[model samples]
Target: MFEVNRVTARSSSLDAAHWQRRLDVLAENHGVAGAVLGILHGDDMMSAAFGVTNMRTGAPVQTDTVFQIGSITKVYSATAALRLVADGVLDLDKPISTWLPTLRLADDAAHRVTLRHLLTHTSGIAGDVFTDTGRGDDCLERYVDGLASVPQLLPPGTGFSYCNSGFSLVGRVIEQVTGKVWDRAMHDLLFAPLGLDTTMTLPEEALLHSAAMGHEHQADGTLQPAARWGLPRSNGPAGGIVCTARDVLAFSRFHLNDGRVPDGNTLLPRALVRDMRSTQIELPFYDGDNNALGLAWFRQTWDGQSLIGHDGYTVGQNAFLRLLPSHQLAVVLLANGGPAPDLYRALYSEIFAELAGVAMPSPLHPPQGSSGFDTGHHVGTYLGYNHEHEVLDDDGVPSLRWAATGSLVDVMPTTEGEYEAIAAGGDLLLYREPGQRRWRPATFVQLPDGRSGLYIGLRAYIRAS
Candidate 1:
């Protein structure tokens, strides 16, 4: 980790070599099949690709190797919608039902759900609704239609829940306005204008490039080609974009340019671009202090400096993007297989510390200096979309137990009213913030109608007890 004060100028020669060595060591350490890491400091950008695209095929990972970026597509989807808003074709504050007429949520709050809610993830729709709506261009349309039967987890604009279905609905609105599919709309409005030729939304287009295959980690400690290569067509608007680390850096640079294309052409209103980085809601339980949600970006701070970024995971592939606007810096990492997250935490922490003079906050873990707080109130089964968490007190040891995944995580008190979930492998997985975060825990408050829930990572998990 290089300190900002310790370094003066951008030297691609020295920085590139240093980062390449770091990437190589990490790849070997984690057994990653292939990986790409990119960094942008002011006007200078450097990237290194290492390992094979697939262990089975032994295809080398080149600079242009395309990998599924997952939910980073939400930022592009949000940008497309902002374009429509810029042209007076759509309104940010207007209810989405006005544009996506077919969208009917189980809750009456559907009438109040606006484009802003969808963009900011405050629409209260369920997350992980990865239903396959077919490969036709009408996939987003059908996906929105199917959402009618989906139950609302909270009132629109009243809470935060990362909703892929909401972005799918936003895609439907883009289709209704442009009379084209979401992918086409994205190309016309953002990709083409930004000269992002290496980026694509479908498998066919991605296949034309040297693309990386997803790999799954096996119980025997080896990687095998994943069963599914691409997400369903319905997920395009949510997390279906495929691109290289270089192209992803270009996308990051475009946003840093205040919504301008490479040729200095204005693609979106600068104000809207600024608004995308502004706070929409507080997410204290997230990564760092003052963590919040922007229009589509996740905002947080490190060393009292603001940062923005998003992460994506599509089955076996994981990607991460982080931006420090104050320093005009961006770092992106794309990887395939199980050890991605571990590598990401280590690599990002080192890069950001050296390049930006900001310490990448360590993953949440119990403070060893202090004894754990009482875990009595937090003990219960909390349920969310297809996932359940049970906080238990087994023989005086507090732990978080997963229902479906069968993973038991020891809970060590990090501070008063907060606990860190220590994974069985001794890694810090997450922090359970009760009274300290903006949103309350399942036991924090009882709803007006006598219902209660736990707020973790912007999702409200109903207390299933």
Candidate 2:
């Protein structure tokens, strides 16, 4: 319920204390157990940590308190691969089979998967449900080898499906090619050079002394401890990282400064860093927003400017890292709680709106584009196991009617190629590729049959050219 003037430009200068107070207010409002906020601008960086790291002990959350970073580890893996590429030790386009010969997929298309596909989450591999399948040394490799037996959900590079297995494969590739473990390779290549001392792939035994305990919300809205087990060290590339808010900001500063450390060390080449921030695949299904997957980061625009970053979620924790390149501003939020995608979105929107002097809406809408095909043409009684899609009318335009678990909702188009679907007190935008296709809402999948399936996650509809 806060407002900022829309007409005035935001000053490059921000009041750190004021921002910290606002963040504290927001944390309380959201019933967050512990939170950390960090911002970096030019040579000046400010960070604040609040709430309790351990509710039982009433331990205060310190600025350096370590928290599980989840998938932000992908950024570390991607950077390591890019470093190898920069050093001529690896090829981004080479068949991953060159490094990991045992790699196979359910379909022959598996041979076509490359390092690029894995980095961009376009490897056609279905994501894995977390399981404690193996011991420390071979956990990631075993999981990756199992990928050959798992059915591919889509053709490589055809669409975006966030696949952690792909990243785990990348980790294996790193180990295979480098003759070192994934964590050690990452440390030698990226973390050590960047002086991110607090960023680590495995929690030290000493971590128990200072790490934050994750929390979950109970039915009565009370917070309770959420237990989480340590992931196998071999799976470090996917989500084994633990770090403090300040360390995250320092790592992000390299990207914000175009690959140079704050002290002027060129850890990553500027050209390669730019490529990492560039969009490799367009994720239209995630929301109407134009999201492009970089090497590991997801790049998007907010309020007319580009931001490069990613968010992470594991069993009992959530984290967000966003960098506004033009403003030389970056924000990192870490919370010890079950993953809350809505909270991340809301906070990001609220902060951006405040910075841009705009009125924050109930749910932020993705940028507008041309409306794609008329929804009516595709509207039908189509069904999937436990999921259904229906086309409905909205102000003379076609919209999606969805029914899941006996709950129904309508999706209306805000712009061409973009539609917003309302569900469970939240809205999500659907972005369409800009073109006419023979298959309307076609789901793309790689089936065991000789032929691939293009109707997996899509709805089929015929449209007039």
Candidate 3:
């Protein structure tokens, strides 16, 4: 149980050493392979790392050991684009076709996509389109060209859909205007200027430091280092940056500083930085949890205190970054695997409650008796980018079965996202992994096309019924 001392919390006295020990025990109990916790409160900061980078190598995770930050890279990509806006080189509302005149998509309406659409995840592009163009300077260029034949899920700038491809498009746009690759631009613009020595965008660069390897749960119920490190290089702008906990906190500090570097040079305009955190679109569901999505940041509510940040997931690594800009506070947790989501829930619960006095909503739990919710809306086959989710009315009870389609069959985890979904009171279908009591919510929302959609693992699947 997480116990908060109100007096110490109210005083804002964060004992770093004490919390380090707590993290040590919590990481072990939750089966996390390796984890790092970084906190930023005003100008003061504290960080802790626990466990090994890789089970096979037995290398202890250090404070500076780099782990994949995943889609948190989107925020970085968005920041880079906003810099273009600050300089009057790029306009957020202008159609991207104005710059990339030859840009094409299967949907006719997609040609009108703007930078704002990409940043806000409303491009309606089929996101999991992970294609390997090659390890060359032309990779991003070729990746964007590949989208010519790729179909768009919905009309551009129409509705909410988590579009990874849209961010890759943003990377392409940055590459086009800057006359440099996305990785090189990152070094010249963000990393070197910000003094982020522990941050890198590729595996060869990660080899220079005590890098963390990703691990996966095997069929034999054991954790093993996976063969895959990350997705294609083309996907880098969307979810491929790797860095240390301290570096993440440092980056967070940069955001808190309103795009100013240590030398006090304004790398990004203060107005653009504020706009990025401002709510651009409200989600259809998740009223109190995730209130809305900003340009790249997630705008949320915790006990009515405004919170903004992003979370990321790759093959085996999970990362969370939450910031209370109002309080000038932030928390970042990067984990290698094994009950990471659960660990963060418990860990952040205590931290935020203590420091910010924000009450996180309780996790979904199965009721004592049957919750006979009408499974009518949920009964259908929901389909989206190489995935299918079928909600079945199993003898008057709702159950969700999901599977990866096409190339994902060879790439996804062992299971097909199987779950014994139980209908709940809050319009959510609850499911818990084997041997885990933490119930997860599978939300049902209406898609812009007026079809019922199921959101599982952050991706939305549209119902065919």
Candidate 4:
């Protein structure tokens, strides 16, 4: 069990030795190739890096090492859009068509999409159908232009679905209003003003010297370097920015400090920043714990305290950032190897539990004398409230699989009754029902009370003959 280390309310720093030990253990035990972490409290901060930036060359990671920040880029993009709102060039309630005439969804109702809808991911726009080749700027625009081919899954502001398409549209809005490309606008509005020198939309010739080569675990349980590619110019607004731990920490702190620069320059109005952090949509697609959407950030409650941030995954990189508004605490974690499918969320939750003086939940463990049953029982066809599962044989051994969602998970029993579903592609959770005839599948569900709950919260499943 993870224990919470008592910290004083006035304490500005965590135990450096404790953080170092946790970082080392995460790297060694979690198959993480490289990790960059930053912790902020009040006016003081601590940042550290562990593991190799490049596994093949065995080069050590430095505090300044840059990693692709994945969807965390959305926060910056959303901030840029809100800044325009502050400047009176954009309106939160006005339709996006006010800025870009070409932007449209299948339904004519989609024309009602406002900057608020785009920022909170309620535009009802579908995400990109093609992978971001990271090749050029036209990629995202072409993707947006092709949206007429796909159907709208939900109506605008009716329900919450994480639409990457909404953010890409935000990028286009930036272009239309500022007369500058999304990348350049971001550089001017956010990065340059804050001195985040390591943040960039594309890998520059200079970054080649220190760029950490991303990697993935191979079939034989060996680490292999993954190829690096440029994110298309179009998708730059959604998930294209790359930066070091220190820079990300600075960005996160800006939100924690109410959208001001380190020296107290008011880059964003406090009211607007508060609006960005306020819950605009109750995201139904994500695990309904405290997961919510506020402007562009995922808002949640941890140990009774509110945290605002987002997690990102692309190519072979995974990143996470969390900011506690009440305490002015921020944490940023970046990893090269994608392990623990839920690595980012779990790490942040554990860290926050410790920081907030709560005991961390026990890790899940597989049933004893049932090693063979672990994969076999969870392998067959199973249906749940929001998703379906079809376990299949990968190499003669059963593995839990989801086709419609494109998730492939390997189950590992931790210690308690919980089982950890590790997907190289991502992470999720599985819990056995205590009294059912077989294992019950857990998925996202919307409660009738207008609240959200997980399947595990309803009842426990137990195996019966």
Local accuracy of candidate 4 as per-residue lDDT tens digits, 1-465: 121222222234576556766776666666677777777777666666677776788777766778888888999999988889999999999988888787766887457878898787666555533344345656556766766655554467665556666788788788888988788889899999888888888777327646666776655767767755434556678888888877887887888878899788899999999999998866543343445778888887655667787877666677878787787778888888747234554566667777765432333443443233334334445432123345454553444443222111111111113232332111223443322212323443443334333233221111111
The root-mean-square deviation over C-alpha atoms between each candidate and the true structure, in angstroms, is 7.0, 9.1, 3.9, 8.7
What residue runs in model 4 are displaced by over 4 Å at the alpha carbon?
1-14, 131-134, 205-209, 285-289, 338-350, 358-400, 404-465
Number of backbone collisions per candidate: 3, 17, 0, 22
- Tens-digit lDDT track for model 3 on 1-465? 212111112123667877687788788888888888888898777777888888987888877778999999999999888888888889999989877888887776446889999999888888887888888989999999988877677778777878888999999999888999999988877888888888889889999998888888888989888778887899999998999888888889889989888889888888889999998998765632576999999998888788888988888899999999888999999988788888888899989988888888776677777665678756889888877878888787787888777655545675386676688754578877664657776778777777677776656777775
Give the top-scoring candidate (lDDT). 3
94-175: candidate 2 lDDT, tens digit per residue:
8788877777887775578889998887777765434344556677777777666666656776656667667888888888
C-alpha TM-score for every candidate:
0.87, 0.75, 0.93, 0.76
lDDT of prediction 2: 0.64
Clashing pairs in 3: none
Candidate 2 regions with alpha-carbon error over 4 angstroms: 1-14, 205-209, 219-221, 230-234, 286-290, 338-465
Question: In candidate 1, what are the lDDT values of residues 369-391, reduced to their tens digit?
Answer: 43444456556777766556677
Q: Which candidate is the best by TM-score?
A: 3
- Give me the overall lDDT of model 3: 0.82
Candidate 3 residue 19 C-alpha distance from true site, Å: 1.2
